[model samples]
Target: MQVDYEVIIVGGGPVGMMLAAELALARVRVCVLERLMETTPYSRALTLHPRTLEILDMRGLKAKLLDRGKPITTGHFAALDTRLDFSVLDSSSNYTLIIPQHETEKVVEEWAKSLGVEIRREEEVVAVHQDQHGVEVVAVGPNGNAVLTALYVVGADGAASIVRKQAGIPFIGKNSTFTAMQGDVVLKNPPESGVPSYFNEQGLVMIVPLPKGMHRVVLIDPERMAVPKEEPVSLEELRASLLRILGDDLGISDPFWMTRFGNATLQAQRYREGRIFLAGDAAHIHFPAGGQGMNVGLQEAINLGWKLAAQLKGWAPDWLLDSYHTERFPINTALLTNTQVQSLLFGSSEFSPSVIALRNMLSNLLQIPEANYRLATQISAFNVQYEPDREMEPHVLNGRRFTELHLRLENDVCQNAYELFHSGSFLLLHLGSDERLYDVIDWSKYKHVHVVRASLAKGAPDWHDVHTALIRPDGYVAWAISQSESNPMEAIRKGIIHWCGHV
Candidate 1:
């Protein structure tokens, strides 16, 4: 049978599902193909950064995710028995959120389904062809061969992406040199105190807290010392190794899932190829260091989703579609580099005495207020900022990470600034004492933008405490003029146009 959609997304993992949801919410017809018949039971990624939380909050899934996961207020970096808690970071989001990747995917899938997106499970995409008009995808489903045609194609299909391959895009990078095994196991004496811990030895032994008193562990050790290659890794053998390293106190019991992976860092040379584009792991793969793999992928989906929708809706300028590659490619490349750095710290055991001492010193330094805050910002991913130099003067906040704030509008009532951003339109926030900037914006001509005003009766003015800010449809700050601005909108406009184009 033949089907048609505004976009056909390959891969139904978290990233793919997120793209599906975004497309459906934009009222764009979408079809997502998944090779798996059911969701994976493994807790692949359990840490959700504050930035990712903010993204989910936009979809109204934050509360539910928090309910399903535990909040880790502290993280400790240790050497065998000695440890240093890096949780004292003076930052807005001081903790790591531990929500299983599967649960996260469930929420996104439900949201996509609610938007009436078609999800085809057990359907394997075999080939992709893009012509001048659109893209044609062939897949094998349960009954027989099926074809799906769409104006655009998005590959969120993980590290080995069929769409990217069929589109002749190059995935450039090195395969993982470090070998590690990850699994969810029952520990006899799991820590019941603050945040879980990482017991770094020759290789890393991490214990990450999961909901319902469960925990996930990733053990990275020398390949030779690891158990012999076997179809199903012997739980008893893994338990023995744990006893040898982390000690017998763990009392490892039932293991829900066990898998081994090597540290392979790879990224697509280009994210967009003609009418087909790549997002998430389909575009890049890196070490699961700092819990950034999943979060980075999610951000890619968010970055691409709105742009694709805008282009399909005929609201985006010609160059806007290509901007997806320009903005995100470098970002993903940086993430890959960061992941590689983290692996060296946690995955390798060839630490000289000097190196060990240096690590300890760095750990202590990270405890300092400024260092902790910086680390927190890096790990939590709240430091993402877009270029702010391209839009018109008096531009609404553009090309930056969106900030959360509470505001009292012209009406006596007050509400959260993000609430106003639900429309996914370009917002023109007129801060107090800066209402005159509104004159520069042609609100009547731009139906896609919203103009509003706000004063402090609601919250403070830190970046996280921004009282009034304009958010782009993709949940980024288009331009933010402080209530005490000295006509700073012009400067902000310079940055906004860099991303929003000349619109």
Candidate 2:
């Protein structure tokens, strides 16, 4: 049975395109099936958090994205009065990048195309079936119906995913409790409040700046809480909501796009089923708090992309593929919980004195540096830590993201940790005088792993007395060895086999 592609991704949005690029980087044959012939004009997600920026930096896309976005040093939590200071994060990319989702899609699509990833536009997936070897996807495109087969199929097709439904994956969560309207419009008289957000008994209203002199206006009208998701948003309704919430509409006119959203949250019971997998909104959906919807989806894509490619390439450990679900399911569950709490905090339809008091108390708590930093880490996703499956005692750096480090190698050559990840391979970085560390692993058998001996740059703390560390392709530490360890060579052998499979 010949497969048309090693992987076929449904939905060519940010998540789908990101995964396609990751797989293509590994020399995997991949294709994307997008229902729309052209990209959407609507700008859904408006910001990318710090961790997302770091992931892009690893792929060398961060500079290009920065050129297209506004780097904001601060972010908000549930539109709280207190700001989440991104400038204090312990990463090179210590800020959020504010860019429209359409622009982001364009950048990623361009990268995927450069990697020779085929995107079949206007192809709407209707049916999917899987066998022991591969999966067949039936879609209707401009040329009519067609069937394509791939070793694996990923559903990034949004909350109402046809692929997830056809795969019989349970999407369990709560229904919509409140509705909101968003519009990108030209203002005859713009408000003086720059990127201002207000929440009160009337409702919540926010105005954010967009490209091309257009402004994005979000309105949550208590009276319109019952509006169906299918209902169209009108300029008059938007004006009334703004007037009710913000005292004026700022003379909003010349609308470019408008849409309605709800607080319905859901998560797929499982991320994989046989040869089928799910990512992005197909796996989870929740309130658009902290602008995390797209960012989390992109992270999920990166986490799953390389593992799937490794499996197809026949070098993946047995637990590698399943780890995608194990690692990300909990993250998505926490995301849903946070957004639900935010929805409650921001909801005005059921506003009461107690709710206001609660909001005030939480807002005050955010003033504390530790409290603010903790929530900021969660929202920025910098606090994500995976538990290593190995039996050895875990070090502090194990299972944590390998932060970009300045290194001075043997020849006085200087480099950063992110530069080693350009090829999407495991990096074995030795940071001490032990040249014998390289002899421990049989590097000849691991084609995708690189070994480098380097010393930490001056003024950097000696990290956990770590002499050697194994970094996964997604930039997380698989395992690390300290100088005080009794048997470092044997530990390296076990770590390689645990993460990189049989050599």
Best by lDDT: 2
Model 1, residue 137: C-alpha shift (Å): 0.3
Q: lDDT tens string, model 2, 398-443? A: 8988888888888889898888898889898887767676677678
- TM-score for candidate 2: 0.97
Which lDDT tens digits does candidate 1 get at residues 1-503? 23488899999999999999888877788999998998897767887877787777766777888887777664333322233223553333346677888988998899889889999999999999998889999999898999889999999999889999999998999965656776687877877754444444444567766666666766755543344323455577567556655665377778888877666889999999899999998999887777788888888788888888888777676777887888888777777777776666664545355655667777778657676666566666666766663543443444657666666777857876666655556666655545555555454555667677766554453553233455777677665555455556665454344444455
- For candidate 2, what is the lDDT? 0.89
Q: Which numbered prediction scores highest in TM-score against the true structure?
A: 2
lDDT against true structure, model 1: 0.72
Tell me the number of clashing residue pairs for each predicted model.
17, 0
**TM-score of each prediction:** 0.88, 0.97
